[model samples]
Target: MEFLQQNWHWATLAAVTGGWLLIDTVRAKADKTLLSAVEATMLINREDAVVIDVREQAEFAQGHIPNARHIPFSELESRKNELEKLRGLPLILCCASGARSGNAIATLKKAGFEKLFNLRGGIFEWEKAGQPLSRGSKNKDKEKGKKK
Candidate 1:
């Protein structure tokens, strides 16, 4: 009690932060906003979820989820209008490790998109799960640039 009295501010801050984290977690769970690779595949197959690759062009050109629309995260806001047509469908955002796409969900939410989901563990998990990626144009171009 004495120690807490002297450190009450620290305790209050800790409690507040913990509460915020708890609520955020609960809300994410309630909304079913996060999707594992398998879940994402299921969503795609059953609901026709549109996968959005937010990695930069070079990264995306290396490989990407099949049929995923490429929209770098930095340009998501400006190019959001392109996604307006997909607004009513489930949009799954992904990146190399899922961090950028997870952060990007907020951008879509602000743009009035309701069915937004982040790919859990991103493309890494997708590959780990043995999901196939459509090799993009860069590989072919690189090969063409090399001459025997």
Candidate 2:
């Protein structure tokens, strides 16, 4: 007890850090806002949720979740109208990582999109989870060819 009393400042810092962590954990749990790759897949397959990839065109062409619509983060506000038809459906936003998608969520939320979700850890996590990604601009060409 003598050692703790002498290092009271250190003890206080540790306590504060631990308390902050506990609060953050509880807050995160209380808000089921971010969806994991598996949960995203379930939403896509079962609920027909609309997946919007917020990465840039080059990044998107490299690969993306199958059927995900491309809308770069920079253009989200301007291109938002294109998604109006899908407003009622769950809109899942994704980027290279979670940060950009989280920002996209705020943008969509301000536009009154209530069923918005951020892809937790974004495409990185999806690939890490072994989810398949649709690759290349050629795939789009192939899809168009099928329609003709």
Candidate 3:
């Protein structure tokens, strides 16, 4: 009790942080929009969900989940009309580390997109899980050189 009195600020900060974490966890779970790589794969296979890579062209060109459509995050708002044709499909949004795609969710939802989902941890996590990546011509060229 005496030590806590001296460190009241620390205790308060800890408590607030713990509460924030708890709330975040609950919110994430309740939203159910964050999907693991494997789950995202299954969703694609079973439901034909559209995978949209929100990374910049350079990052996406390095490597991206197979069949992911490249739509840089910076242009998401402006290019939203392009997505309207795909509105009915379940859209799986991804980025380098999921943060950008996580944000894309609200943008899409506001556009009346009902089936938006975020790839939990994004392409980095997908690559970490040993999932296959489809690279642009640059990587293809490197692979071709290795073949020769």
Highest-scoring model, lDDT: 2
State the weakest 10-residue window (summed lDDT) of model 3: 134-143
Score each candidate by Cα lDDT: 0.90, 0.91, 0.90
Candidate 3 local lDDT, residue 2: 100
Ranking by TM-score: 2, 3, 1
Considering summed lDDT, which 10 consecutive residues are worst modelled in model 1? 136-145
Error of 1 at 116 (Å): 0.4
Clashing residue pairs in all predictions, respectively, total 0, 0, 0
Models sorted by lDDT, best on top: 2, 3, 1
Error of 2 at 83 (Å): 0.6
Cα shift from native, residue 97, model 3 (Å): 1.1
Indicate the TM-score of model 3: 0.76
lDDT of 2 by residue, 30-123 (tens): 7677888999999998999999999998999998998889989999999999999999899999999889999999999999999998888899
Q: List the residue pairs that clash in candidate 1.
A: none
TM-score of each model, paired residue for residue: 0.73, 0.80, 0.76
Better of 1 and 2 by TM-score: 2
Off by over 4 Å in 1: 1-31, 138-148
